[model samples]
Target: MHIGVPRESDPGQRLVAATPQTVEKLVALGYDVVVETGAGADASIPDDGYVAAGATIGDTDAVWGCDVVVKVDAPTVSEVARMHADATIVARMSPDDDPALVEAMRAAGVIALNLNSVPRISRAQALDVLSTMSNVSGYRGIIEAAEAYAGMFGGQVTAAGSTPPARVFVIGAGVAGLAALGAAGSLGATVRAYDVRSDVAEQIESMGATYVRVDAAAQESADGYASELSDEQEAATQRVYAAESAAADVVVTTALIRGKAPITITAEMVAAMRPGSVIVDLAASGGGNCELTVPGEKIVTENGVTIIGYTDLPGRMPKHTSQLYGTNIVNLMKLLTPGKDGQVVLDLDDVVQRGITVTRAGELLWPPPPVQVSVAPPAPASAPAPAEPAPAVEQKARKGTGVLVAGALTALLVVAAVAFSTASFASHLTVFALAVVVGFYVVTGVTHSLHTPLMAQTNAISGIILVGSLLQIGSTDTVVTVLAVVAATFASINIFGGFSVASRMLAMFRKEA
Candidate 1:
């Protein structure tokens, strides 16, 4: 029933596991929360704020000793030693799978829930710390690149000279890569992006960056991740990566698959880059996508190129990142505490819970059964494509249908008019019947795309009907009066509804004041 927030022991880590916002959520879930003093200080959340959210401030041991302890990084050796037997710990556990740490948790009787191991399935996205961290890292990575670059990002047409925009090439069109593309594009940079999954080309272009297409037929991934490429495919993709990175003013590499990161930019590629060009490797924490990237350090190559491999990009913006991470944990907590009784009840059979359970009750339960993220891509088409019908033929068919229907109806009405109407009334009936036929075909023949404008402009006809109905609203015959009133009521809607839609559509073209 007691959940705890522990201060991040890593000096470089500026994020907190639970902010006051998340603490309030925990309290609402029927759990008493204890916050280690100054745990959220790095993220600008004060102890008083935690108290206001129904959490009590306590020492490190007091907080860690609670039934459920939350953290940003994997527990350190000394940190894990302080945990009481059967206590649960949650964090974005490292992928290295260190044996010593595993043994320590097992000996301490700790239940370890690795947030990084949360499945990529749709239901588990809310608790996925990897994506939450990557979302912030992607945006911050661009800012980090701008800081290292020598020139401005956007173009300037000054009286002195016209400066061209900086060119930014992003490798990997994952969450981080797409975010980098958006930030770079917003800064007026000429952005271009590449991804091994050809299906993400539309997503890449939607971020306002050109998607570098490769002459290959790669289907969408089976698990929402980049699958391992064959040797020949890798070589072809690498050629494009090298050429783009070398030519760009700023290159960002965000390729990370499983625990290892492939070398996307090699030494020869780095050497080919122009002087003062900057490269930001977002996958630095997971080894690195760039050969020159030194994890946790920024190094300048001999050719005057800056290679930034900062592993704490998300931590750099502590406030927002902490909130994002805390919300992710709160989502996981909500799932675990479904009864709202302050008790942690995990459904081990569930893919999400089973996947996150690294060590439970002194037993290692990690490397759970693989979860299939998506069904296999459909088999290719066996038949060849046929040419489309000619536009003239298509147009002729549409015109024929409406006219034929209207003419048939008109002929039937003319026969009825002749049989039912007197001599004087027959001529009036024929004229009205002709008008109805012309109106029917005219309205029906318009293209579907023009319906909006047709409705807006057709208000004049509706107004005529409304006026005609109004003339009969005072009819002496009771049945005639009721029918006329109903017709007027329906006609008024067409007139007013048309005006309302037209006004709303016009407003879209006007500038905001």
Candidate 2:
């Protein structure tokens, strides 16, 4: 099958559907790739780059005429009408309940895959355009905030005085929210984040931000996305929001619901901030999380607070964002072209592919079969009851038995030293006895669940012992020499065995596993 990459006609778009790096991947999969001349120019990619990557640079007609047409935005109806029947067009088509585009796809008999529709399941994460773009937007939000703010993000300690770090409050702990909070924290800013889902609190804290606790967000997210809060709950949350926003030096909002972002920062909250403070609204395209945000514009409040409402945060950093988005396309291509034989196969049985497919077989297939986004956690096993404590008399008897065994061993060692041992031999036996007792206590203290970690620690100890014993191998005393040899042999075995077990334990943590 032939794949085509056309130049984006939209003036505001700086991203390309495919880049030089991704074109190479498509060609490696046995597909002839065609790119429109200067398609990647906005992203700082030259036409020669695509050509060097095994893509043919061609005119608009030549590129769009391929069997599969890939794009960043949804192609217009006129553009879709230009494609030949049975050809496939793939893009991040946020149809937004548009019937015209679906009707056009049906009439043209073209296969349309909307990257925005990619499932939220773990297996489909690579193909998810929303989260991928949102991550870039989140990081870019912090940069824009820093640029507009008067003071530094990080606190400074100079000979003159000490400066406190700027406090950042982020609303919504999703991909964008986490990224914003992390970026802010990395810049030495104090960060705080809040989410309607309580489960994300740990994630927020892991990013070096405090999770603002709210009692009203007692909701479970079964679809990998936060569920809508009730009106009463939202009001309860707004009450807490006022306090958080008031204390923040820079505020970022990323909450979205049904394509509309509800207001979390009111005008009163903006008025409470200091004169030089800034607010970056990442959800501006979705009506904004700030009630004062003007979409696609930056404005300063009368009180000297800056409110930024940028719809193109991802476009601000085009080079890397293009690469990431292009790679997502390549991954989707890899899934569709399983055989690497230049054939496109639409396997509806696969959830990832089916979820992105909007129109196929001369019919509109928007809203594919519903998939369960969240995996149901397995039921935990019932724990066994605790063992009852032994009687006081029984415990005392066991302790007495241990003391007797110790006394007998000490007597035997003393008799051996007095009857047949030299001073040198006695010193060696004393060291050996101490080693045995310490090793026994250390090994016995470890629980079964911690055996692997214990092995890791013991491995280092064995290495030291092996080196020390090797140094003592030339001792004149035969007993000392033999004991040294035995220690070295056992320590060698432990070193190798411990490494093997440790490697297996690390393999269990690999991302693929």
Candidate 3:
């Protein structure tokens, strides 16, 4: 088996598909590795490194003519033309977003395995190129924002005066959002995050940042991407963004709706933000989260707010990006490698294979056809049989049994109510404790993804509890008054906290400027 590593043809692409370290692994796996000259120069991997790792350094034609070709970007029409019929090509080709790529590969009789299509399941994590790049993008997004903003992220105290910490607002609580949150928090910025998926609130909170809660229902696709919001939801979200952005010194948007343009940050919102603030839109490749963002360009609004919209952030850190991406490719290659023969095998029954294989054996397999199964034919219809009547004695017995059960239940309820009404304070407390325990168990059963929304909803309900606590605060007994005051204080915090979080979450989705 021969595996070729070609230089990325895209002008903006700096990372290569395989590093020398991975090339060595491929060699050890019984494959002859061929790398295009200067293939890894952008990533700092020299041709000598490839040679030392047991790979042949070859020209473009020799490299692309190998049995299997690996690349960073989708193959160009010309590159596809160079591929031998039935030869395999692997890369991060977003086929669904560009069906022409699939068609071109099929026409060229090339097998196309797209790295972006790798599944998000735990078993495929090592092969997840999207996740690997997203982590880099998220971390880089913060660095870019920090560089653009003039103010310091962390608070400082000097003999002259004290500087308050910068406020960072992050939209989206996915991998990128979390990375941004971590980066910002580490720099001493007071970070707040919002996501359409309410379940990520706990994750945000766990990262030492507040999770903004919103009133919107949780929306997530089966693949874990956020679904697009309706017009009404967008409007509500904009209102929240207006409030939060006004107070934010730095805002990073990582929201993405798969296969569609991102929900944009409105021009009005930019105008409302404090001057000198910076906005980093990581979704710039998908047309940006900010209306003012120009993909791959940085622009400053007349009001002094800087909007940085560099689309390929991961590419900026090519060395590490190439290493991570190369590892992912190696993992994927292991899955596709056939036993003994060392040939690339396409197995539709394998989850990883089915996901990444866009074209197999010269056939375009993306948007895979629905599986068809044979069903047995129904038997010919026959006349209905007469229904059997219940015996009078049995019917009477059933009625009697129902009455007896109802009477027993009623008696048990009456006895329990009477005992509770006459119960001592200790007994009442015991019952309350039991109820709390039951509630704890029930709440624990809820999925982690719902924690954010659940927290928001609980905060709303806590308002009613606050009112009850306030009423009790008027009692004459000193101890009772003290307890009531504490309860009321806690309730007030819960109510206000929930609304604050919800408002922040809604702000991320806000469509207005």
Candidate 4:
């Protein structure tokens, strides 16, 4: 079988259907791969690399000759007219009431697989083009917001003064919203997020951001998308929005309504916001959520709020986005024909393939795609296995014994070193080092028995600071009068304090189980 890849026609669409690695995989599977000249150039896959991977470079005419045609975007009518009668085509063909494209596929007699129609299931994750694109869109949305907002994100407290962190509000909790939350949080801002689905509130909070709740958002759509709020709900929502808007330094809106113009944020809402605030509308391409939002433009309201409504946010970082989208296409291609050795295999019984296939057997499939079914993964086992206590207990016992022995040896060494020094501070240094060894051993033993990270860090900090001070001041000689103070300051922190910490930790095993 032969597979073909043509250069995508969509403007700013840099992703190629097949990468050099995918071509290599196809060749290993026994299929001949052909790519249009310069098809993957934007993705950094050189022509020589594709050739090395056993793929042949060809003109558009040569690509249209293959049994299977792959692409990143929906094929145009002219491109579809060039396909062979029985060729299989796979790409992100949106089936949202596009009767014209559906009819065109029917006329061409092509087996059209809409990759965007993948079910939201564990098995479909590897082949999900929407999620792949959403991930890129989400990441890019934050970066653009950060660039537009001219203030720093994180709070800084120094001797001079402290600057309060920027307050970031994200108006969706889907993939893009979550990514925005993380990116904003990493910049040290006080981030808050909201979603129509209450289930994701905990997830937002877990990422160290506050979850803003609005009672009016309970009306979610059947497909789990947020529905447009009723007039009454919208009014109430604006009240809450006014408060948050006044406080927020940056607001990123990622709300969407599948197959419809997005819900609008009124001019009144923008006017309510503080001056110099930034609002990034992620659903700008599908009509924006903000009245001030102009598709592909950044507009500042009369009062001073910046509303950014740029379409194709993912295309801003084309290299990484292409890599991800290309990988998704490769995965689906491999799954559909694992045994074809690069040949075409039309398996109609497969659930995913059947669901997304728009045309097959010289007829257009009825009820054009987005077929849903419960395809969730099996729930993980709730409980973990009971762990064996013997090994853990024995390890603790051994550690206790070592600690006791090391502590005893350290105590003896400290006494001997101080006795020979015969300085006025020798006694004080010996006493302090011994005390540190004892304290460290006790804290470590307690923490080891408990197995708590917080406790361990607490004890570790205590030991380092205490023993360090003692080591620097403990040792001195009788003849060295003036230099004795310097020696005490340096040597006490280095020798006594350092050794005491080591000795105490090792002394844990010296105790009986």
Alpha-carbon lDDT, every model:
0.85, 0.86, 0.82, 0.76
Model 4 quality (TM-score): 0.69
What's the TM for model 2?
Answer: 0.76
Q: Model 2 over residues 259-372: C-alpha lDDT tens digits?
A: 688888999888988898899999999989888999999999999999999999998888989889999998998899999887899998998888888888688777888778
TM-score of each: 0.74, 0.76, 0.71, 0.69
Better of 3 and 4 by TM-score: 3
Instruction: Put down candidate 1 lDDT per residue, 1-513, tens digits, no spaces.
Output: 789898888877889998888889989999999999999888888899999989999998798789999999888878888889988999877635777887788788888888988889888889989888888889999999999999989999998999999999998888899889889988999999988888888788656689898885344566668887888788888889888987899999998888689998999999999999999999998899899899999999999999999999998999989988999989999999989889999789888999888788888886677877875654579866778867998889999998999999999987987998897467545544554555456555643333565683575465555655666667577986897799788877886786687688879969679
**Candidate 1 lDDT for residue 272:** 95
| CA error at residue 470 for candidate 3, angstroms | 41
**Order of candidate numbers by TM-score, starting with the best:** 2, 1, 3, 4
lDDT minimum window of 10 residues, candidate 4: 446-455
lDDT of 4: 0.76
lDDT of 3 by residue, 1-513 (tens): 899999888877999988888988887667899999999999888999999999999999998899899888888878888999989999888787777768889988888888877766678889988888889999999999889999999999999999999999998888888999999999999999888888778789878898877787456665656777887777777777888888999999988777445655789889998899999998888889898898999999999999999988999999989988999988877887766345777788987778787887677789643322213333558857659989999999999999999999998976777676754444444544454555455555644443576794575455545654565577677887898799778877876676687688779868667
